[model samples]
Target: MNRAFHRILIANRGEIAVRLIRAARELGLETIAVHADVDRAALHVLEADRAVSIGPAPAAESYLSIPAVLEAARASGAEAIHPGYGFLSENADFAQGVIDAGLVWIGPPPEAMRLLGDKLGAKALATKLGIPTVPGDDSERDRVDRSAEPKDQEKADAALIRKAKGVGFPLLLKAVAGGGGKGMRRVDRESELPEAIRSARREGHAAFGDSRLLVERFVSPAHHVEIQLFADAHGHVVHLGERECSIQRRHQKIVEESPSPTIDPAVREMMADAAVTLARAAGYRSAGTCEFLLDEQGRFYFLEVNTRLQVEHPVTEMVTGMDLARMQMVEATGKDLSRGQSVVEWRGHAIECRLYAEDPERGFLPSSGPVLMFKAPEGPGVRVDSGIMAGWHVGIHYDPILAKIIVHDHTRERAVARMQRALAETVVLGLTTNLGFLQVVVRHPEFVAGRTPIDFLDRHLRDWKAHESPPGAEVLALAAMAEWERLGMIGSGSGPSVVANGGSGADGDGSSPWRQLGPFRLGERRR
Candidate 1:
C-alpha cells in the first residue's frame, strides 16, 4: 500500500541536510530541520521550512539521540524522517524507533539494516550467494565479541593472533560495526597485531557502540570501487554504476568519480550484477552502496554494504541523471520505480572532491573557525553543494567537511581538467583547507594516468607540504586593508573593500579593485 506524506523531517545536519531539504521541496514536501544548540544558525536550519533544536553541541546528545530526534519530528508534525547518510542513518534501532513512532522511515527495513550493518553477517551472506569476498579468518569473531575478563581477553587475543598468522602478516583489523574509516587499522607485521586489535576495538566501540572486530587480508595496490544501488518495496533493484574512490586518507575517501577509469565493460557488468544480487538477497530498500576492492589482476572482492545515502552520491547523480534523495522518498511511500535496468543510462564522467576544514600538511587535523569568505566556482557542468557561507562558524562538534564540488564532462580527461579549474577558482578563506592539496593530487602524473590505488596518498604524498609561495607584500597589504575595512577599523571613505568574485563587497557600479588584481589565491594566505 502506497502512503503519501506531506511533510518530512531531516534528522541530520550540514550539507546533506540542506541537500535533502532541496530535494523534498522539489517534490512539494515540507521540510523540518533538527539541529544541536551550536547549529541554531547553521545553513541547513536557515534553509529549512521549520527548525527544531534537538539538544546540545555533542552529536550523541543531539543527532544520535533517538528520543530527541523523534520528539522533534513529532513536534514539527512531520510524517516521515530522513536520516541522510551519517549519524543514525545505518542504525537499525533508530529505524525501528521511527516505525514505532508511527512515522515513515525513509530507509531500509530494520531487519535488512541489521543484516548488512554487521560486516561479518554481510560477508556470510555474500559468500552464501556465491559473491566473492576477501579471504580472512571469520572463525574468531564470536570469541572477540564475548571476551570481557582479563583472562578471556588474553585468550581471545591469542586466538586472533594465531588466526591472523594464517591470513598473512599484512592484514586489516576492522570493527565489525564500523564506517567512515573508524575502527580500522592496517597491520603489516606480527609485532603490530596485539595493539592494533586493542586500538580497533576501543575506537570501534566508541564510534559504533560495538567492540567486536574482524581481520581481513589487506589487498594493496587495489582500487576502491563502489556500486550505487537503489531498491524498492516492490522487489525491484538496480545499480546506477561504479564510483572509483581510491584517493583516500586514513581509510576515508576524499575524491570519487563515476565510470571508474580503469574498469572495463565486462567487469562493470559483473560488479553491478553482484551488487544487485546482494541487495535483493538482503531485502534492501532505498539508497545503498556496495563497496569492493579490485586488484590489478581484475579480481574483485566484496567489502561491505553502506545502508544509506553516500556522501559521493552526487557523482553518480551527475553521470546517471538520477535524483537519489527523491528516489528514496518515493520508495519509502511504497511506490515502484518507473524505470528498469534496461532503460537506465549512464552518460559521460563525473568527479567529486570533498572540501574539508583540515590542514593536509598537518596530518589532516580538523581546522575550525569562522568562514570569512566563501566563493564557489561557476561554469558549465560544475555543481557545488555547500552548507556554509561567509560568517558561518566551523566547529569541532561535527565532521569538518564544508562542501562537495562535483563536475561532469564528456570524458574522464575533460572532467579531470574541469575539476582542476573548479578547484583553482574556489575560494575559502579564514581557515586551513585541503583545496591546494586536492589541486596537487589531480595534477599528479599518476592520478592523471588513472593509476590511483588504495595507498595512493601513503605511497606518493606521505611527506606532502604546501609548496606555494606566500602572498607577496603588496597582496598582504591589500588583504590587511580589506580586513581593516571589514572590522570597521578604517572609515568607509578611506578605501574600497576587496571581495572575491560574486561577493557583495563591491560597489553597485560593478567595478572593484579585485577585478584589476587578476587571479590570486586568497585562501593560500595562512591566518
Candidate 2:
C-alpha cells in the first residue's frame, strides 16, 4: 500500500533537470528544482512549480553540495530528491545523505552506486557473476572475487607495482571514484608506472578528492554500447534497449542512439543478460546504465555501471515511449517495476545528437555567450530537450552542452533522415556550436554507412591541438584576413572580402552580423 513518491525535488540543473521536470509532470507528480545563482533564470528553475537557491555558480558550492541540495529539498517540502545524471547524482555519500534526511533517493541504492562506481569493483563483481569484463592479468588474484582486494586501487604503492608486474606493462590507471575520463592514465612500461600513478592520483584528488585509482588493460577499436535498465524494490527489472555511444570525445559521449545500429538481436540479448546479471548481483534498483565495450569481434566487455539517470535516457524514452524519470519515481515509491515497464513497451529507433556550445573546426573549443536566437526543430518524430532559451546566456563555468536533438522513427534509416532534417533546420545566433560538424558527421560516409570504430574522432582529426582558446579561432582568423584584403580594410590593393558586403557585429551579445539565422516567428512546426 505504498507509493514511491508524490513530490520529487530535482537536485541538479540544466537540460537533465528540465527533462526530469517534464517526465515527472506527465505522471501527475509535482517537482521542485534547486539552482545556483547563475541559473536563477535557467529554464529548469523557471519551469518547476517551485525553486530553491542552493549556492553560487561553482558546482562545489551548489549542485555537488549534499547539505545544500538536501536543505533545498526540505525547504521546498519535497518527499524525494531526484539527482539527475551529473553532479551529486552518483555520489554514494550524497545518496546516503538524502536517505538519512528521511526522503526517498530517486536512483539505484547507495550500496549499488558505491560498489559499481569503482571500475575495479564492478569488473570483479561482473566476473564473479560470469559476466565478461575486459581481460586483465589481475595476477594478484588468480580469480578476482569482489572480495579480493582490487589491485586496481591497492592500499600500497609496492602492492600496486607488484600487481602491475603480473598484469604486464601498459595498463590503464583510472580513478576508482568517478567517471567521465577523469583521473585516467596509460602506463606503457615499468618506468612509466610511477609517473602514471602519481598523475592519476593528482587528477583523482582534483576531480573526486579521492586519489585511489584502478589499473586495467586498455582496449581499442571498441564501440561503446550501454543498456539502460529499470528495477523496482520487488526485484523486477527490464532492459529498455541499447544505445550506441561510440561517437565521443575525451571519453564523453556526444551522440547516442537507441537500438544501436550495430547490434543484432542475439547480441543484444547477450549484452542485456550480462548487464542484468551484474545489476541483480549488486541488488541494484531504480534507473541505471550498464556500459559495455563491444570489440571488433562483437564480443562485449563490462565497462561500468552508472547508478542514475543518463543524459541519453531520452533516446531510450523516445524509442520505448517510457518515462524513465517516472519509472524511477515509482520504483522509489516501492511499486513493482514489471507493471510500469510492462505498460510502456519500447518501440522504434531513436537518435540523439548532443548540441554542445563548441566549435568543430577549431578542435571543438568550448563556446559560450547569450543565445540571441534559439530555435528547436519540431515535427512528428523529432524532439529537442534543451536548457537554453533565446535570451539565455551561456556561461564558462559549466558544461558547454546547449541542447539535445533527438529523432524517433519506426526504422533507423527513417530516424536518420528525420535527424538530418532536424539538424538542418536548427540554428543558434550567439556562439559557434557543433551544428556544422554534426551535419557533416551525419552525412559522412563512415557514419552514414555505420562503419565507424571507437576511435572515429581521433582518426577524423588532422591536427591534435587543445580547444581552450576561442572556438574556430584559426578559421575565423583566416577568413578575417581574406576579408581585410578584399574589402580594402588593410589597403587599396585588395580583393573582394567578406567584410566588403557588410560590417561585423558583436557575437557575444547575440547581434552577430556574420550569422544569418533569426527567430522562428511562425507559430511552431514539428521537427
Candidate 3:
C-alpha cells in the first residue's frame, strides 16, 4: 500500500519550510506554504507549488494561529499538514486540530505528543522505563501544577522554593512545555530562585501557553547530546544516531554536529537503547529527538523529547544519507519503518552552523533589514538551506535564523574545515549577521578538538566579534565597480568602452543616446 499523500501543507515559515518543499517535490507531492503578510516574498513561498496568506506579521496572528493554518490547508486542498520545526510544530492541540479537520498530521500522534510534551509526565515515564533522568523533586510535582489561586499560589511558591533548595543551587527553572530556550532560567544562588521562577513562568505562559515549570539540578560542563528516532504505526522504531549540540548561547544551540566526538561506542549504544525504549513506551510515531545531558563523568540523563523534526536534522541526514522529511511524510500516512535498526548506518561526520540576523558585537541582538546581496556557498560536501534572497526584508517578528549551512566529510576535522571555507565563501550583505562569529567558533581550538560543553561559547568566546569591518567605502566601491562592468563600462580596450569619463557616451553634438531625462546616474566617473 502506498502510504503517501498527494499534497502536503507546510505550516511554518523560513528555511525549514523550504526544506520540506524540496523534499515533498522530490517525492512527487505538491507543496503548499502558509505564510504571514511579511513573508509574501519569502523564498519558501516562492519555491512552494502553492502559497496562502495566513494573517498579519505577528506570529500570534499568523503562524501560531491554528484556525488560520487549517483554513489555508483547506483552501489549498492539502491532504496533510507538516509543521516544520517551530511555531506550532510540537503543539499537541494543533496536532489534534489538524486531525479533527480530517487532515493528516505529519508528526507523532497527538496523544504521544501530549504525554511527552509535559516535562514531568515524560520524566515519570522515563523513570518507569528505568531510563536515567535528572534528579529533582518529583514528590510535589502535582502540587506545583499550573493553576489559579492567590492563597494556593503562596503555598505552591513555598513548596517550589523547598524543592529548589533540595535540588541545590545553580539549578535551571525550565518550562514543562518549552523548547528552544524560550522559558528557561538559570539560578546560581538561592536568593535568585524566586525571581527566576516568576520570570520563567511568565515567559512560559506567553510563549507556550503553559506556565507549568520544573526545577532540575543544573549540570555544568555537560554535553548536550540527542538521539534521532523514527517510528511508524506498525510498532517499529529505530535510532539513526546522535547529534552533539553543546555549542550554544543563552540555552539555544547555534552549532550542532553528528557522531559526538566525546561519547564512546559503548555509551552511544546505551543512550540509543534508552531513547528507543522511551519512544516505544510513549507509543511514539513519526520523527522525534530524545535529548540527554551528558556529564563529564560519561553519565547521561534523559532531558526531553522534541516531538518534531529538529533544526539540525541536516547533520543527521548528511551522515546517514536519509531523507527524514520524506520519511516523515510517508509515516504520517500510515507506514512501517523502512528498515530495522540493524540496517541503519552512519558513515561520516557532519556539522551544521545556523546563520542568524544578529549582531554578535552588540550582545547578539536581532538585526532586521533588506538583504542587499545574497550568495550561498557551493561545492562538494557542502549544502545551504536558506529562505532569503537579495532584496528580501528580514522581519523581527519571527525567529532570527536566516539560513543553515551544513557540511559533511570523512572526519570531523575535515568537516569543520569545509564549514569554515564555506562560511568564507558565503555572503549576505546589507544587514548584520553572525557569519563571522560562526567561522571563528568552527575554527576555534576547543571546537576543532570537539571539547565543547553547554557553556562552550560563554567560557571561550564571551567577547566574540567579527574580525572584518562592516561594509563601508571599499565595499560600496566594489559593488559599484561590479555594477559598472555589468553595464558595459569596461571593455578589452585600454581606454573606456564608450566615453572618456565612462559617462553616457554623449556624441560630439552632446546628444547622448543613453542619457535619461531623470537625475539617476548609471556608472562611476573614471579615476
The most accurate candidate by TM-score is: 1
- Superposed model 2: Cα runs more than 4 Å off: 1-4, 137-171, 186-196, 339-345, 462-527
Q: Write the per-residue lDDT of candidate 1 for residues 272-323, one digit (tens) a residue.
A: 9999999999999999999999999999999999999999999999999999
Model 3 lDDT per residue over 164-280, tens place? 898997888888888999889999999997788778878887788876778899998899999999999989999999999999877899999999999988999999999999999
Point out the worst 10-residue segment of candidate 3 by lDDT.
Answer: 514-523
Candidate 3, residue 364: the lDDT equals 84
In model 1, which runs have C-alpha deviations exceeding 4 angstroms? Answer: 143-151, 472-527
Segments in model 3 whose C-alpha atoms lie over 4 Å from true places: 1-4, 138-152, 471-527
How much does candidate 1 score in TM-score? 0.92
Please say which candidate is ahead in lDDT: 2 or 3: 3
Number of the top-ranking candidate, with lDDT as the measure: 1
Error of 1 at 425 (Å): 0.3
How well is each residue in 1-527 modelled by candidate 2, as lDDT tens digits? 36457788999888888888998898888989998999998889888999999999888888878888888888888998888887888899989999899998888889999898867678889888888887564332332322212345544556667777777765777777667777877777898887777777777666675666666777777789999988878877777789999998766788888778787789899999888788888999988999998887888888889888888888998887777887787778786655543464678889899999986657677877767546577779988888887558888877788899999999878888888889877866556687767776677767777766677887775443323333344444464444354435656643222221232322333433233322211111223
Candidate 1 weakest lDDT stretch, 10 residues: 494-503
